[model samples]
Target: MSLPFLILYFYLMNFIYNILVHIAYGIIHFLSLFNQKLQLFIKGRKETFKKLSVIQSTDKTIWIHTASLGEFEQGRPIIESLKNTYPTHKIIVTFFSPSGYEIRKNYALADVICYLPFDTKKNMQNFVRAIQPELAIIVKYEFWPNLLSQLKKEGIKTILVSGIFREKQLFFKPYGKWMRSFLTAFDHLFVQNENSKKLLNTINYNNVTVSGDTRFDRVYEILQQDNTLDFINEFKYNTYTVVAGSTWKEGEELLVNYINEHASENEKFIIAPHTINSKKINELRNSILKKTILYSERNQVDLKEYQVFIIDTIGLLTKVYSYANAAYVGGGLLTGLHNILEPATFGIPVVFGGNNYTKFQEANDLIRLKGSKAITNQHEFNSIFTTLKQDVNVRTTMGKTCGDYVKNNTGATQLILNYINNLFQ
Candidate 1:
């Protein structure tokens, strides 16, 4: 291409990217008004004003940034470890997405849980001046070019934990020079696998380590906690139960079809969708032929008789899976993959729709081990679910595989915590 055409192409592509992001931000802001949980997100920045004031008064502060609730949870062990190791430093937590800030605004460990402003030069300049963090940690794939560069300029030691990279991502592309600068700002890039480390090395970014994924540790922690859910126990009643978590509409549709055609009269099912929009709840209820209960509306007794139960609330999915014999994970269809680790830790074989899941280590690993299966449509769903249900030995063997996979992946949280401890020492 000629020089003028190349310049025009770059300008247009940049323009489109900015426009799309801005439009998405506006839509998120608009949507936050109607939902109570979402309103908490819209008001997250305002809510952090008091916390920021407190931090401003403190002498030493450590700043941790996470993109969403998943990242927040993944970084929880590290945050707790930091607080325990260095009790004197104030922890300032920031989120680029409202989903992260809204869920964790009231976290007692964090002095502040604010929405990070758009990563503009002025925003980073002002934010860095105000917070003045002694140390900075970013969870997962949250690299903002201006913010990272500003942190480096301020002599703040920036670290990335539980990070992952793939061959297809922008950083690996030929014209990714500008994007690669963000990766370079990290003092240490603690990635999930050797693949991520290799990709970073290709960009001449050598300050990296393979720390594995902290989420495995997080889910294992959940397993060690008391696994008691009275309602789920009554519904399960020593029967084989399938817990389908974080299901999107596409996955749910396929599940309903499979249940209609093949699910035995004795077996039970539990569904926790990614989002519990009332419309989605009703749609799922309408689609299924068997007796069903919405977790929000049903009493404990109501769920016991139903073959399927739809979880309409958040925060209960991990606990609900404790009673499951098998689990069908959600997010693979349209959105992304939900927490396969939560169910896998319980030693339950998992199922899900397939797409956009190169980042999920446990899911990919489980498939390779034959403890998890991915389906493209109703036909595949029926085949997988039918075989697992009818064959007891296969079910038990796969369940064992699921448990073992989780056991081996433990200690990422500890590895990260050890790194943080070494820094202060």
Candidate 2:
């Protein structure tokens, strides 16, 4: 296509995209009346512009935008490093999801933390004009066309951190040239692997660096923290414990069957499901025929007497991972794979639902490196865990592989900082 024709084509495609965005907004607004999650999403953004009005033009601000809590975590290392290196600069962190903002609305590091208003041309323009940040950092997989174009038009420096690109993405499709142009909005793209870089090269996005995940650096730092929990020490005393974090219903059922039928007397289990509500908690508790105890009942019972421990709470899974001999990091049973990296950093052999984890580069790397195990059925799950429990040398080697993987993958934060240092100077 000619340059003029391409420009016209993109404008038409962008108009269509904006229509879809508005339609989504309408659906969300209507659904909010009946759904609490959608309600929070709507309520959170109501004050975005009013909240953004507080950031002055003269403020030396760095704006970090993340789609949700997971993306926030990936970008956290960059945010903290930026804060420490440039203490005078104000950091404004914005989330597109209520899950991230609701959890970290008062995050001390960011000068302002709020929900990013829905992507419309005016919202993008107004939001960008008001903040006028010196630099903008977008964490993994958010490609808001209006927002990115607005930032580029204003000559703001924008980069993507911990970005993972695949050939399967729309950007590579024959019909995806409009979305491919969106990549040009970013000044630099720091991706997780060379494959992502090569994928971008196919689209002429050459300003790319293969900077591994910042979360590797985050998890490595976990080794320095005080990961001790007294009740866990008591319950997990000397016995081989399997710690499963972020277990969805499918993973929970598979593990429960193993606990009831195949588990040895010396083996104990700790399960932290992805969802925590009374009905879900009770359903899980009732299914385990073994002496199972919920986290809420910890103080009331003899912790060691129970074979299965259910953590019906949040914020403790990472710490609880320290007590595991073998770790099952959940969410692979379906599509939403949780953090396998957490357990991997703890030097334990991590197992997860097998099928969907190919989308995660870290999971693929770990699986290939023999640092993690992926199981799709009860038999595979039983065989893998049973082997890890029975064979000390196999367990030791696998655990070492996981630990080494985490340690070797550290310093993505420093790599990013090296690039950003020049941006400041």
Give a tens-digit lDDT track for model 1, residues 1-425: 68798778766765665577668657877998787776665576555445566655456889888888888888888888788888888888888666566557789997667887666566678788778987798999877766887998888878999998999988889887557756767889899999999998988888888989988888888877998988887777788888898888888888898788788888889998887689878988999998888887676455677898889887798899898888998888778887788898988788877775656887788889998888887788888788888899989999999999988988888877777777877
Number of clashes recorded per candidate: 1, 0
Off by over 4 Å in 1: 1-43, 46-51, 300-302
List CA RMSD, all candidates: 3.7, 1.4
lDDT of the structure predicted as candidate 2:
0.90
The parts of candidate 2 lying over 4 Å away from their true place are none
Highest TM-score model number: 2
Weakest lDDT window of 10 consecutive positions for candidate 1 = 48-57
Pairs of residues at least 3 apart in sequence or in different chains that clash in candidate 2 = none
Give the clashing residue pairs of candidate 1, or none: 331-336
- lDDT string for model 2 (1-425, tens) is 89899989988988898999999999999999999889999998888888877787778899999998778889988999999999999999999888678778888898888898799999899899989988999998899889988998999999999999888899999989878877888999999999999999988889999999999999898899999999999898789999989898899889999999999889999999877778999999999999999999999999999899999887898899999999998888785688888898989899999878888988999889998888999999999998999998988999999999999999889999998999989
